[model samples]
Target: MTQGVMSGAGCACQPVEAVTAETFARSWSGVSALAWRVPLLAWALLVVAWSGASFWGPPEMWFLYMTHWGLLFILLEMVFGVIVAAVKTPEKNPDEESGLPWYVRVYWLLYNITIPVAFLITIFYWCILKPASKNTHVNYAPNPVLDVMLHGVNSVAMLVELALSRHPSRLLDVVQPWVFASVYMFFTLIYFFAGGLDPWGNAFIYPVVDWSKPEQTAVVITLTGLFLTLMHLATIGLASLRDRLIRRCRRDSAGVYNEGFTA
Candidate 1:
């Protein structure tokens, strides 16, 4: 009778141990999968496609000039840094991996400052210099497909960064969307102003809208911008909320398991 009781207790413990090990393995596997699916690669591919298409496609000079080079620089900086880092120091712990390295952090700091500087430069070109040059041919209407691709890449990058980063506080999530919207709004204003001043200015640049009149253009641009801004805010808010809830549930489950084990 004593031997049988001991044997039953050992069997129960073995199953519990097996289950804990399985759970740990699955968690590790998930972390590994997330590391492999880096969002920067997707952004790089999109940049490459956009740049290649600009070279081969119709002569949308302004679109090609701004987007092709801008994206190239951004993508080159991001992708090169990540690839080199991966080759040199592949992350052993995927759960603790981060998208922003030291260099990337510095780069973003500079990028944030340079945005206002770039906007000032654009203002100088459009408001002061372009008025005298007599070249009233500003074409602000970019290809809708390309715009979609670019913004889509940006959205994916944001989400992936949110997922991979260790300290995903609510503050970061709340501020990011507003920052994005503000930058976009600034660019849109510049583009619209420049396009409006041009003699060949057309409202619809890429068949996405009929920007035939000033009022019509305003309505379209304002509505679209508002909608996208709201969407971005909602996406980040929901993702962060979901992450927090899931983490809390996992902690609760683990606590219960530990208590039960102690009992």
Candidate 2:
């Protein structure tokens, strides 16, 4: 059993024969419709409240930060999830796991983008930037509660969504976050040359992202790219573990049901 667990005997790391609308709509461990709806709605509300409270600075500047980018994507993802969960999915037999649809594929891609980017923003901020800010005596925390919500709670919400959702994590989808990051990097380059300022009125939007020092910034980007790769890999691992646990629970339940039937 231990070996089977370690080897991922029943994990859904890849797509099962075929993915369907239910793949994106249902919860892995839940039978009720409320499973997906309740959490998605809660996240949507929290995102709106936190974003509104912290959105006091120059309205335009909010789009310039990668933090806001993650928040915005998460909000959109949750709203999409809530809508999708409301729709009635077509029922099929256990053996009929075929006919994956285009929109379901798009929803899965959105999930791929949403989960990792949310974690990337949270880890990048708290692990790397927060300590550096302290050394420079830069108080990025104007509102401590808002800071935690943006950087800390963002990842927690994503983690919960990860465990609850039945979506499969394709390894190839790891490039999704990298593409998203590249777009923002390109924007920052244009913003730098155009002399865009951070909310603090500095010529560079982020101290760590100053293009004036191209070599240093390039190294930071390189390291960050590697970290992003690891983050996605870690997400895949966690998803596998969730699937493995679910498989075990289902197996045990089946065993008891069979024994009772025989009795």
Candidate 3:
């Protein structure tokens, strides 16, 4: 039931069936698997190093933040992606879409959740958090480098992966991200009640997320959930557009080859 099955018309909007092992192992560009694996490996290492350094520095409390959690997701996604491409075996019939391997499905699930959440973290920080911090004279970003890496590079990497990966986006995948967001909101409530503090020693994790102001916090959560839904929809649309463009290009190229051969 979870398998992506295309209709007779090859509708790009339908969830795609599990693809070939090679497709899972390589990029949409048809590049060598090493070409895909090496970059992911390097970035994974970088994420590990940065995370270690961040923890080692002052105010380790920042680890409690959602941006850092997003970083963790990025690292996990890359590591699992490398493993899948390296060790995943082909199905009995390469042409058939029985279903993805369990690990492959997990990796796809991470990709779906990670990408939009990364963007959400970035958007919320720069647009909402940073501006509010400015007026309050609070320093949300203690380190400029870490600031850009977490808020900027995370989303950029997700964008690059989106363009390169062969995996199809499922509209149903949005539920996974929504559930993840709900978990984090629940955590915030617990953290607040338990007397957790932001790095600056405030009672709330973020200035805008004041538990004492329940109405404001509720509005923030509701808006954030809506934005996440929109982001996932946008992700699906991008994948569909990429598929349509690739199919059109292949058809045109095949037509050109046939015309030349017959002439």
Candidate 4:
């Protein structure tokens, strides 16, 4: 072959991989992923930045709290979600959703489960629950920003994310809420038994989990479990409804296209 022809052929033979437009763009794999993820992630990151900055006292105390746990979980899901959306390579199995890692998937379920649980904490602590028994829980100076983040924004963000994100929800997903609540319950018991102290140096993390009253603790947990179960069921119902509506719309569009073709 001529030298010029050989050089041209070699250049042409090298494979050039085409990068997708979304490769560098941050987006969600699911349809409404961006609508929900951006706000949820931004809110969680705000809280995380403040917490990491030592705004809420020692990291030791903040990390141990349930509020912080939920916050971190939100941030984790959002961060990992963006990563999976951008970096995941499509496989032969189109059935798979988001190609989320096992850890991220687990946390995703936990995040859905923890939504109501976090709100329960917020409603009780920030509402009249704290006032009814003021001496029991920690009495930190009020910061409206932190208060809103803890009690109000957390649940609101989750609900908003739910509205924007599309995912299949099944009855089996009920286990998620139980698993989350059980973990915190177990931790509370362990903390009680181990003599762990709260931010104010109290034995129990929440004033309600008194070591002296095991029966009361059991009752409280049982009630919480019931509430969580109800909430989980409601989530399933809504998800199922959404799926049906989407399918119906697609079917109708297909029918319209066929009619047009026939005409």
The digit string of per-residue lDDT tens for model 3 on 6-49 reads: 32223323334445455656765566555654686587578657
Q: Which parts of model 1 have CA positions greater than 4 angstroms off?
A: 1-34, 37-43, 54-165, 169-212, 252-263
Best by TM-score: 3
Question: Which candidate order results from sorting by TM-score in descending order?
Answer: 3, 2, 4, 1
lDDT of 4 at 132: 47
lDDT of each: 0.39, 0.69, 0.71, 0.57
Worst 10 residues of 4 by lDDT: 254-263
> What TM-score quantifies how close candidate 4 is to the native fold?
0.71
The estimated TM-scores of all candidates read: 0.41, 0.81, 0.82, 0.71
Candidate 1, residues 93-211, lDDT tens digits: the string is 22222333444343333323222222332333344333543543443324655544543444445445434432212222323434544564455456555663222444333222233
Give the C-alpha lDDT of model 4. Answer: 0.57
Error of 2 at 25 (Å): 1.5
Taking all chains together, the TM-score of candidate 1 against the true structure is 0.41
Clashes of each: 1, 0, 2, 0
lDDT tens string, model 4, 1-263?
A: 11111121132122222222232122123353555566677878988887667544566676666667777777877775555444553434432444434444654565566556666666656764457446654654257677677767877876655444444344555677687778878888888888887767777666666666889778777877787777666565654455446546554321000000110
lDDT at residue 148 of model 1 (Cα atoms): 47
Segments of candidate 4 deviating more than 4 angstroms: 1-32, 52-57, 93-104, 124-129, 132-137, 244-263
Give candidate 3 misplaced runs (Cα > 4 Å). 1-18, 32-34, 55-60, 90-98, 252-263
lDDT, ranked from best to worst: 3, 2, 4, 1
